[model samples]
Target: MSRKIREGLLMLISIVLLATGGTILYRQLLPSSAVKADGAKSGGQLSVRHAPEPKADVQGRFPAQSVERYAFSQEGKDLFSLLVARYQDSIGLPQSAVLFPKDAQEIASSPTGLRHDIWQSAADIIARKAPENALFLSWWDDGQRIHYLSGKEAWLRKPSDKTFVGPVWKALQDSLPVASDEERARLAQMARWLTMDSEKALSEIAAHFGASRPVYLLVNNDLLLHLAEFTAYGGTSLSLDSKNIPAGNDLHGDIALVKRWAFEAGDGNYLAQKEGNYYRVWSTPDAKAKNTLLVRLLPFIDSLKKLPKGVSLVYQSHWGGFLSVYKIDNQPIH
Candidate 1:
């Protein structure tokens, strides 16, 4: 009731209020996960920020050469093209999606025989615009090695001699319901290589996997080896073979043979017989080729001294994809 008592009570209440406010402010400044909830839902409120999607430059696989230009030349450019069109137009089939039923069915019908052009087109598009974080699909390659590439690496694999393509036939069976005699024959052939040797299969397949991206570049062993060396040593530098070719155990089985084969193949720039340990500028009509080549050579120049006697070398240059070669210093020049 007294004025001094009234003033004293008001001051005490203000001090309590200040203490409460300060406690809240300190909690707010605490690191997330450190802050305790005051009877809030599941701990506390989560501050969410809708970040803009990463503006990454997407890349896709482009056909290095037309289907008609390679080994399947005589089939007529239209033959394989027509096949792709039929697969695309088929009912209950998928146009382009990883492990889609339609794609599986198409593989079932023609296990070792896919339209290369269509595959390349689909692959390129998928690389450029990745709709998902991961993609998985079983593929067949007859006895021929399947080659898939992405970013800086390439994979080569040959299916077992007896595995039939399962998904393809499953799709076909789903749509056709009743298989004609010819369809049955195709199905049988597709499943011929179904069972696999788990050990060898796993070991061989494991080499192709990459940490950053999934495998995409698929080709036969011959083509795969050719491309690997091309991409590995900056598009087949001239120096790779010239210096290291002589210092091997055997001519046929030595590193020299690898170099020779690479050169004999297309874009044999792996043997860069240049005077300096630097890459040369080079270009190709094929963007995939150019990119692979560039990434391969950028490392060799920096580590030239440590290069193995039997190893290949690709150097970097001012321009892209061009290569330079050097031999190991202690290699026996036989």
Candidate 2:
């Protein structure tokens, strides 16, 4: 070969060798699933599972006496029992259903210790009370527990899901009392769309969910208590406290003034003291202030007691009222 040609050939071979080594290294670093045809990440993506068929036998396991002491009311007891029974059956231990702690003090002392157990209990209730293919509507936080523990379907598994960007999510966001009059009006309209006892609104929601799957509204008590924080901060990372409230903001002064006034005024709508460092304040029944979605939703939730003819409060429990299930009796398409 000519000297120039030999040199050029050597250069080309070196470049080829370097490129081959780099490609091999890159593939080795990539996750197994990432190299798949679908380009999914290994163990990083959630797998969608088929909804389980409802079982009639599961209902028989829950007895009112079993959960009576754990619950506050007869309805609460029955619901609690049903959830416990459901959880027991779900884990393939039909004979060993989990029950609430016999001593209420134990729960009060260490609520955090029982958090997962509580979640599992709530999941059981959802699994048993809701239909086989029921689609639960609730905040994204509870979606995973309902899905993995209960084997039920949820509208959105996480807040960042694209499905959260539409009217329903917007309505929920607008439902917060922290906005303009026009915004509040929009919020009111949306609240009515979901929670109103009107046949038309109920029908619209049913249509939104479609005919094949029933829609169950799941309300977590903790979610209701901290709704203001959720609305303002979009998560539990922030709370309504003196430290969290920005300096010069009206809310800080308002809360302090409300706390002072509560000592004299006694319990009323505008201010009330909670068990711990928490306290609640609102502008008035006629005019709700910003960051008070929880306060606003409370009365609306109470109104569920007298639901329209077709709607029903299927379940409620005492453990912080941790779970409330509402069913809209719209016929399923399937």
Candidate 3:
């Protein structure tokens, strides 16, 4: 695990986030000026007024209609509705059926679906460019995909007795529907690897997955929305506070109402939202939640200035910049 991975073909990452075409202005925030004393500080706690605008350039930039489409978009809604035509009893259509043309277009409009291109792109990289017999580790979902498409070995394929429940709450998430014992202890450890800070997380990943072959970690950008879902799994304190404002007659009033919620930017919190169903903002302004592995891996949505240590930005899809691959550095296997 500590030895250097046999030098494999490293596919340089193409910074093509704006592939859909739009002026991408990587904002340069005035460090101290990004926040101002607007008579907003209260009880030694910071308020939105202290930092009225987003402190960092977040990934959920209210996606423009013509650009990238997610499962939560209007188009995604229509595709998902069509995809779920048969499965009336439960949400098994996506699991059992093939991802036809609709899958490429984004059918699962819930918080978890992404354009198939990202996964396919990463798979292509591993299949065509990466070295043979290299080991890949990731959240089980993408890990299984990499193994299948790339023909590479992905660790922790399936966790048993696990079920997911997704809800729409003004960008906020609540407890999922009851299910049989959801034992995701190992998967929870993977989540922890993503949520842990750079230093510790790097060591942990190497210890658990490193070997003579190269170990690559595949991550999707959509996990930014999954912040709340895996808190219990990773045993982290970070929280994603969400709020959705349905387009209504009370435009101004609702707009003002939208501003009120668990939002505090000075604490290094960013806001993201879904404009299709609602003016839904995906926000989690936890002052202490900035430097997790999840945030650094997917800078497309979350607010991380740079990628974490002990990982190299090996590849990124040229089509839709929704997923990324990282080559883990050498570390002692504990």
Q: Which residue ranges in model 2 land beyond 4 Å of their true spot?
A: 1-110, 161-203, 225-284, 287-305, 308-310, 330-334
What is candidate 2's TM-score against the reference?
A: 0.40
**Which candidate gets the maximum TM-score versus the true structure?**
3
Estimate the Cα RMSD of every predicted model relative to the unseen true structure.
Answer: 29.9, 26.3, 16.0
Model 3 weakest 10-residue run by lDDT: 21-30
What lDDT score belongs to each candidate, Candidate 1 first?
0.24, 0.37, 0.44
Between candidates 1 and 3, the one scoring higher on lDDT is 3
Candidate 1, residues 1-334: lDDT per residue as tens digits? 7867765564343222222111010011123332111212233322211112111211122221111110111112111101111112123322211111122224222222222333444344444443233322222221111113121111111222122122222222222223345533433332221112222323333343433443222222112212222323222322222231222334234323433444454343332211112111122223233233222322222122133222233222211112122212221112
Give the lDDT of residue 173 in candidate 3.
15
Which digits, one per residue and each the tens of the lDDT, describe model 2 over residues 12-85? 43222222211010011112221111122234321111122234323232322221111211111211111222
lDDT of model 2 at residue 271? 23
What lDDT does model 3 reach?
0.44
Find the 10 residues in a row with the least total lDDT in model 2: 21-30
Residue 68 local lDDT, model 1: 11
